[model samples]
Target: MAKPVADTFSPSENAAGYVSDDNPVLGFSHMHDSGTGGLPSLGNFPLFVHPGCPGDDFTRCAYSLTFRTTSRVPGSVTAAPGYFAVNLTNSVRAEMTATQHAVLYRFGFSGDEHVDVLRDLKRPDEVEKGVPYSPLVLVDLVDLMNSRSLGGILVSPETGRVMGEGRYLPSFGSGKYDAFFCADFKGAAIRKTGTFVGNDAAENPKILDGVGSGFHIPGGSAGAWLQFERPTNNSLLARVGVSFISIEQACENAEKEIADWHFERVESDARKQWREKLGVIEVDPTGVSEELQTTFWSGLYRTLLSPQNYTGENPLWNSTEPYFDSFYCIWDSFRAQHPLLTIIDPIAQTDMVRALLDIYRHEGKLPDCRMAFCKGFTQGGSNADVVIVDTFVKKLTAGIDWDTAYEAVVSDAEVEPPNWGLEGRGNLVSWHSLGYIPWDDTDLNGTGPMSRTISRGVEYAYEDFCIATLAEALGHAEDAAKYRRRGGNWRNYWNSDQRDVFQDPNDVTVQTDYTGFMQPRLVNGTFRYHNTRACSPVQEMHRCYYDTHLDTYEGSPWLYSFYVPQDMATLIQLMGGPAAFVDRLRFFHTSGIAYMGNEQGFLPVFQFHYAGRPGLSAYFVREYIPALFNASVNGIPGNDDCAMGAFSAFAMMGFFPVAGQDVYLLSTPFFPEVRIRARTEGKWSVIKVWGFDPEGKKKYIQRAKLNGRMYTKNWITHDFFLKGGTLELWVGEEEGTWGTKEADLPPSWPVEWADGGGVGLDDKF
Candidate 1:
């Protein structure tokens, strides 16, 4: 039976790639998502080692038929940031490392006269033989984002070298494009080169067809292979180059990246590069365990995996500007990951905005859930708007062309694209016309996917606020005023009758009821009622609601009720005030409705800060440390989609970002000291954080100091961190209640700000 694998070491396979301690070894694959929540996207171009069995043809044998590797012993498989290694049961050891666009493979054979290097080429919906590979490499074009290959090719230019180009469609996208590769062999004692097809072996066919079947036959299993004689040092090496443009570019990239066969030098250089990037933030590891250190460091490592650099890889019109892809959706990442970059790596963030602009220039809109070379689904709003505005508000928009960006943002808000599935907002008209999306009216309207109308309403509200915030920052007062009114649309969904039930307040049970909360509204301005509780079982909720999708894009209505960050003060009043807001915040955890694993409900943990309960926020954040996350392969709670790594990183670093704002809410970090070389404007500013929790019992911030002076507030502003200085916090076990006062609270949109452009049902109808 085909059982699922847990990629404890290789998180890149995302949720699907797991090589468990108990499971037999499946060869390592290149190209994978670190911790994404969807179906595994890339496991292409795998490299494995095989033993010499009776009747085993190195060039013809299937990869799975080979003997599975023995259990990995400690130090037997060494996987660092840019490197990996494993020893097979056949006494064959394989070590691999990577550059930005290339990977190097080194194989060692122990008690053998000869050994086989294996690769099983897979193409979507084709016979295994149809998947082509030269003596060089294979371009499995049909094998893409859970989709089939439209077409692809493999080419062998000469002995010891291979190149290929292919195209495939994404599983979740609406477009297709080609990818290319070039690989070269070195230090291997090659005795012969041959081809394998359905347990049959044939001599090497020296073919170089970039458009035709290079070497693959019509049906059955097939791949190219090489039998190596016993080496001088019992080892051999291979280098593979990858590009999205063309074969020539792939070859050039390979040549430019790893010219010489210095494996150790390449490995050392890769580790150095990782060190430099990860060095942006430093936490003292004096009191933490090795596991905690691993969790912290690996969490940071996952953060760097995506928004991959496709700078010279765009197959479209040529330009000097940078291009990036692999945005599963901005909804997942813009929350914490991108915001964390502003502190750790702002240049990358600035370039990311530039890349978004370039994508807008070409695709006519910024990418939403983009996968390899194609556009995917839009989850909530045009969340890229929030990402751009978040960076802009934080003064991290250094090299971005704000004027061009403004025009694009305006276009997204003002005009509805023809295909709502592909780009721009098709629901803007309805949202503006009715001031909210009506659940029953969706059938009568030509707007967005109606499955999560309430969720979309809230997301659009925040996104509009983001756009408005940017407009105001850029001095477009009229546009800002228009969007600010639109941003208040979230108010329309508040069903005043729904109230939360804390079953047993004194006990810590995982059950709370948001029976009275944000409910869907009908076209007649009446609330659409449902009988199921927010925490109801999935089947139960589905049975109760008719034709309407109850879940709100990985969250619940009660979870999203407090999502009114644009005007939290009003939301607080609506929820009955600070104490009630804190109770509702607790209700998320007690009721088990809080989606702490993903970004949708990430803000609620910090919402306690806004509710004048900084200590509770700190308490919950600290509780999440050992329960929800770890350093193991499955350490990630859910899809490390986009910026999910930032979630962990933020918690460990003792803060959380309120998206679309320039502030970071406070908490007590796990470490004694944390330091960041924050980049702002055109200079580097050092921001330092110190925690005085030596005994480790203290989890709440009792008091704080900024630049040697007493700091009253529980949060830090972007400007405060931009012009960096020391931030010291004295922590304790009990609730401090110091920041609960109104004057000490973080900035929230006042109810008066929405007076002129109110969006209640009465105002529109």
Candidate 2:
């Protein structure tokens, strides 16, 4: 829960992307959202450390973020799973760790003896022996974006305890939220206490309350400070508890969770929690490189960093149901991250599903993205439908209210909210009538950005398909048939005449062999011409964000066209049978069109499995693993959004999930053996490779045996994990015929749409 603090040298307060090596040290805050794009989220109430202002003068202390910013000692930054440490040029070293709702920091003040001697020599009268070492730490009332609207801080003069609350805007959504913090210090006596506004700090006023205008001066800083006497061991310990409820609750949360004031104990507890969460899946790692292992574990670590557990901290409504925030965006996580969690951490997944249903119970619509107790902008479809159905298909039914879950997803399909950009689906009337979101469809029911026609059309189709899966399970036959037909709406956006052409840097246009893509259609039922490669990395990469008028969201038609996950059988046929489809898919990857950075690029990496080329799927998994996803700082190609790590972990573990479905496409694992402890039966499901290759060759799967029987299917079901078994794969240097037969392919929607409605895959797997 403790966020590392740094002051950006760039123009904006949140520039340099959270914490950077170039930015100076700003102090540690108690809350943050990791691996998210857009403006920064929740770096509020940061507490800065100063090793006693020069000459023991209170005014000499740097109270503002600008004046207090100190360069970090080069190469001194160190971080681990639950711990972080860094040395500053001010001769102060800061180390921190955290509990669920509280953070414990140990600030060490090791004065530079040589610099002290030089100061004494230069001014003998002002500094008799050496500079005083009284440490002064302050808690600022500002956030990462300085978007504070109303804030107040109160410092206890005798105890040096600071309590504050502020209403600030969410990083990526509309409206504001209230956050509170309580900070207490140990290892030092309170010498004095006061409040500061900007650089002017005084000891007279111990309480400050103001609106946004009052704190908008020079540095946009206002907070309370506690000056302490020189510690007996030159170190001070500060514990901060944060909550969305109230300052009293924040203090209670801190005192209840971290009453011992033991930094090592807190750090140890944090590490233990992480180990328990990540230890369910164990890899042998015998044939894996250290870099690949680091990539796998680090990616796994990132997957758990968000959708933070704010069960009781939610102040918007009181409910006994579990509440989780920082979904960040379900559009990103529903593809992989939530699926990964459904496998390894089903308990958390169950809680998240319950939380979504609870949100729908109060908010009237399932959120597409949510954080800071506020609604975030919906990136594409109501993808939370995918998350709920994925969990239901995997059978994570402990405390899940399936009745409410079905109602929520049906609301997304049949009803339109007033503001569809933040929650639920837009253009519902057209989605129901025209089978696609037209580029210029006029929506009278609700308002939102009239963009992402192609991307949203495919995503909404898949979402409806997911709802169909749940409806069939819950015995809602009519609802099941209706949504299942709507699931085929992706076929409406298919412009058969659309041709893809590439333009070089010299402005020469060259047509390609591939034809037909999901193009934007106008309200008049005529397809509008949109470049097939417009939003791809090789073309206008920045054209498809939240506010863009582009037809796709963060992807090209080439990528979205392959996003027909619910009906890959038809998609493969439309792209020209298996041979042509394989050729086009290979060209999409080998050419510069495919980018592994965005989450949309993830599924296509393994789409070859649908074409009966499971070997090529294995080939591309190796291609992107250590290439785009690795162990370096810039390892992830794009905004992680927690999905990058999920993609890497699933790829390295020898299987990739088709989200919202029960299918897991099989491949050769990077490790010799991978065992996952199933949450259902509490038994281990093992994937063991026979011919292990440490030199990185022999990745193609030649044959496979499940529970000592011949298994030729290219995909496995969630039941394989629910009921434990051993899946043994023998590898060779080339593709083999084990899972190449047409019947061995993963289950797909029928090619022919029947009026009575095609049967869902619920009973097939």
Candidate 3:
């Protein structure tokens, strides 16, 4: 799918795709991946527009990307569901919208009698003063990171159609991909066409091809331009068709999708598509502030922006399966984004699952992260397993090949790829034999970042648990039992004597009563000492990342210690039963150790339900909703990765999903009523609140009912949404005993297995 976006030039190297404010407009490109981390991606073939050059000299127009940059007018940028518009200081206003594979842009000219050439040059001295209104647009054969290795551009003399293709590196993945675009213009007669290299322009030879000596162009700019005569209406429309296949298909896509070149119609159609997608979930915003409402709806909007539908654009292989790209790293999205999609848009989710299976069919492994037809780094476990199983458990089986899906996940659990850093799991031998990813792991079977032992161990266990769920559902009982036992490997990293302590910004040491944390262990069975709060917000915050030597990934042991979602019954007991578990979780959230920016922190907010205190879960949900998440310009706490929006949507809707499971932990919704129309049955599942508080004071559920029957458990399943029913909750200011009983806790594995020990079935909670 096309995500035509403005590539703003920012000093921040990790400003992926786009930035909202405090950056100059680079150019409007036809493709981009939003909400991803690391260097910018796929801002290829950016089209920069110039109203006119001084003295009508075509060479006077800026040709290089750095020279062509212009500041955006302050307070003039507006973005909606499907349309984005901005005013440049150069006196040209640009607005754009898109279809599946093409972008339509409407550029409005100032129509001033006099052109500002000195100002365009950023020089004080005035040279040639005035010229009649005209326009010059150029398509640069370069990407956001200047990562073009080889590219070519051609402009048609008769039609002024600009077609180009570039081979560039993916933002966070291995290998390179080729992107193609076909740009067409309307509303003006073609004055001239030419190709440019660096600052030099020529009128002859409409094509320019360059092969870079390295990943980037050897020196300067290379592109094609189409100069236009002054239009009667002083406006121009540009339609760009993009593809991962070929330029001919790109042109065909443009002509088929936007042949009429009607800007308003395209924009309207895009808005309608977005509305249909977002209209599935309806919330009563009568009592909510506009800010909170914006937060809620915008979060829903962001969730649909990624894992884009690239059904027919894939060029890797000829297949009939739907090809959805830009997984943009599922490590961040598997927790909430995909689960939310299963409820609101099962058709798209089913297509995405089929896409994953197709990728496995061709590549021999499920990618943990993928974009632009390239394999991205595996941050931890094979998390696509979580996504596939989540859909399976939710019964999104419209067109999914469940047999192939099962084989895909089993391969992730059993096989090791050649370069596990890029795809599949590494150290599977150690994971199975040692029951943990040892800190000093010797992964001779494959290679990857040897650290994140404790983090990867816990994640791999949960991933296997997800696969076990599917195996059991498919009657593979032996496989189910084996993976169910492997799910307890998280217990191997639990070091009981590790104490919690933190040194604050003021150099003051703060010690806590909490003991026991997920620590790194050597192959010899000796626990390695890792600070309990090493990568927390209060401590070495940047120490744990993709390449860190730390035992955790983007979080501290204090946070990952609460990650045994497969069997919280055992985890609660290990932390000294439900009450003690609540105390420690509260400390983790309040003691500045938990950072909501990362996806790992999302589940712990609702984990209180597993401790038999669903009211406390509601309390924490409120604490983070308007505090860390709001509608301000800098609304989200950190990198979105689409999961931030999914987290907000799930939180405001009064429930949270444990990914790859059939459960949805219930809490107090920000709205008085929420209605979700199921995609399969065409019926609505409504959650209505009685005694609702607009001020968010009454948050504890006193009691609940499903379809007029009394309901006590704090969690619901996918059946509630599929079958269409009404869930009613009566809430109060006081902590309620409604969901506090041991029997009301969310489901978890009943048996507990120690490291290298046989499983023991314990019914006690």
lDDT of each: 0.65, 0.85, 0.87
True lDDT of residue 548, candidate 2: 87
TM-score for each candidate, following the candidate numbering: 0.87, 0.95, 0.96
lDDT of residue 324 for candidate 3: 88
Question: lDDT tens string, model 3, 203-297?
Answer: 87798776454434333468898889886698999999998899999999999999888888998999999999998999898878999999999
Instruction: Tell me the lDDT of candidate 2.
Output: 0.85
Tens-place lDDT digits, model 2, residues 710-757: 999999999888888899999999888979899999988853342211
TM-score ranking, best first: 3, 2, 1
Candidate 3 — which residues are off by over 4 angstroms?
13-16, 117-132, 211-220, 505-510, 680-682, 756-765
**What's the TM for model 3?**
0.96
Q: Which candidate comes out best when scored by TM-score?
A: 3
**Prediction-by-prediction clash tally:** 14, 0, 0
How far off is residue 380 in model 1, in Å? Answer: 1.0
lDDT of 1 by residue, 1-765 (tens): 001111232323334454445444544444554555555555444444444433444444343213222334334767787778766444557788777777777876664444333221121232222212112122222231334343333434346565555555654557776666666777644555544432445555533233223544332123345555555676677777777777787778768878887889888998898899998777777778787778778878878777777787877768778887777667789888888877777888888889988888887887677877788777777888888888888888677999978987887787766665556665665677777777665433234465666777888888888899989988999988889988887877776665443334455443344434667777777777632244333213232121236535556676678788788887887776788778877866665556566677577878888888888877887667667778776676666774656787888778889888987888888788887765544443333334556445688777778888888787888875576677787877787866778888888764323222222433321
Candidates by lDDT, descending order: 3, 2, 1
